[model samples]
Target: MYINPEQLSSYAAKFINLLIDYSPKLISAFLVLFVGLYAIKFINRIIRKIMEKRNLDPTLTKFLADILLWALRILLFVTFISNLGIETSSFVAILGAMGLAVGLSLQGSLSNFAGGMLIIVFKPFKVGDTIEAQGVIATVLEIQIFVTKMLTGNNQTVFVPNGALSNGTIINYSMQGERRADLTFSVSYDSDIKKAKDILLEVLNKNPKVLQKPAPEVFVKNLSASSVDFAVRPWAKNANYGAVFSETLEDCKTALDQAGISVQPFTLQK
Candidate 1:
């Protein structure tokens, strides 16, 4: 179809008028968006500083800051759009619907996220703590948003989802600064129980790592067909637990051997 010059001119004027009418709203929207973003950043900075001052958990602090920043930015964008003569109720509805869909699809991730928050809040365990959870005994390396990392005694790294970690039983070994080391030794029935107990006490007392406050204990715990068992319990600083345990066992055996204490050999059952 061929257009007349007059019609073209009229269309151009109307388009120009429409642009002029929307220009102020568009500029205002852009200006507001820019200013709002800057304000959001500033507020987030303040929030981070507050969190730091409160000594909040680092993982949860960063996660919360990111969430707050995104939420505010989304709200600012909706306001900016509304300024451009867009209806915001429908926008909010659409956002809610989209959030529901995303939530359903990311259910496990959301559970993990919630679990992370719980861990941060409740503080069942923290980084560097020796913990046993989910059938794994390890030191907590990091507590992340979705997973927890751990280092086992054998120097193996493990990653467990936060959901299971939060929901399961957790044994925090390091919470107590000192731990009791329980050692058992078997001696032939011919050996004097009193002599064995005294010797074990001597070995425990000589160890500098063992604590004196609780005092060491040595008692005949069990009597078997082959030998009598003595239970030796000593308290030591958690940091020196392994060393104290191994050294005490070795020293006890050496001292007993030197004293001619007879130890029965273990025999396997057929």
Candidate 2:
């Protein structure tokens, strides 16, 4: 075989020319990537400030800002790649296919994520609120992307899926500044109804935790063959509900006993 020095020289010259032509484009892509990342951070910070000024939910605001920043960065990366002379249409198609496959595989997780978004946006309950949902009564500890953490009355931590929580009935006990404690006391049929009512009202009035505005009420709620039930309802600040309720019941019992009132014994219905 015969080798040609002129042909080898020409091939080297072509390689050098191609590298020279692509150098600026490669550098431009790198510069664009750096600027794009900085821009994304700045945009996210601005969004956070705006949401905070509007008093938006912290969970929702953070989630939205993160999603927006990532989407923008992804677009920027695609543009950067295109500047390097790569066709991005096929790349985008591949990404779309991957996304669809991931979505299908994580249906439940996606549902929970959506539910968490709804929870944050609508705010049926917030952190520190005492709520009952999905058969669990607890104080909300944290609202995460896919689940909510709560502390139960017994001091147990429970993680509830946002999917079921959003769809189920939720009772937010702390939404209102005040809550009512509905307590019942039973008296023997032989006891005086008016006397029992007065005792219960006195107990309620003396309790400092009970709210004075709504005014406590004690009335005969039910009359049975063996006992008469009196309803003792008192309004208290949500934070003081447990203390006020327990104290009222104890005070009512002591007052009734001192006043010679008899409580009815529990009897199974025939």
Candidate 3:
């Protein structure tokens, strides 16, 4: 440890020179990073407002805003690195390769994400809609990035993957504003067909939930080995479908009982 003062001073000078040369670039990079982050936030806010003004779906709005924010951040990251005199081509290439690998590993998740995007864009169904898909009939609670959350009639929460939902057949009962309730009531073969039909029609007409425009219809649908089946078709607003259906069935049974008609127990077929 017998270093000369001249050599020590030379090392100190070189260190100070290096710091001096890099300080401005470092400061500029930090400044760019901070400003870029603020700009991204401001841009995201503006975009959200625009989407709201256009009355876009809330789910779509959030998804699009997040995607844009991340994209801008990535670009800003590249700029920040380049300002520090670091080459970014290799960095971007690495990012691309990583993204590709992640994408390949998450094929199903990516499919679901794509499906969610399509649902948001096309709007085959929306929140609060009664949709039947994949053998589940439930009200849509939330349309997320990879799955659609639903509330079943029995208070069960179901998550349906958006990939299968978008590709499969979706029956949106609420989209039409009105739904036709198809009810089948079975009675003894000895019951008077005309009397039973009239009684069912009367019950539908009296019910406030049933729509009067489309009118209700009751007809002999089939004759089983021991019972007669009557198809009762009634139309009601989408919101009142469940009420109308259940109420009509109960009222019809009561009416038949009062009219000396024996109702046969029937099992509902999905």
**What is candidate 3's local distance difference test score?**
0.92
Clashing pairs in 3: none
Per-residue lDDT over 1-270 for candidate 3, one digit per residue giving the tens place of the 0 to 100 score? 799999999999999999999999999999999999999999999999999999988888988998898889989999999999998989889989999999999999999999999999999999999999999999999998899999999999999999999999999998989989888898888889899899999999999999998989889999899899889999999889889988988899899999999999882422
Residue 12's lDDT in candidate 1: 99
How does residue 1 of candidate 3 score in lDDT?
71
| lDDT (CA) per prediction | 0.89, 0.89, 0.92
Q: Candidate 1: which stretches are off by over 4 Å?
A: 1-34, 57-60, 83-85, 264-270
Q: Write the per-residue lDDT of candidate 2 for residues 1-270, one digit (tens) a residue.
A: 887999999999999999999999999999988998999899889999999999987777777887898889889989899889888999999989999999999999998999998898899999999999999999999888889999999999999999989998999999988999887788898898898898889889999999999999888888877799888899999989989888887888899999999977652221
Per-model TM values vs. the true structure:
0.81, 0.83, 0.89
Query: Which regions of candidate 2 fall more than 4 Å away from where they truly are?
Result: 1-26, 265-270
Per-residue C-alpha lDDT of model 1 across residues 1-270, encoded as one tens digit per residue: 898999999999999999999999999999999999899999999999999999987767887898899889888999999999899999899989999999999999999988988998899988889998999999998887799989999999999999988999998989988889887788998888899899999999999999997898989888887889888888998898888888887898898899899866652211
Overall local distance difference test of candidate 2: 0.89
Residue 76 accuracy (lDDT) in model 2:
95
Error of 3 at 20 (Å): 3.9
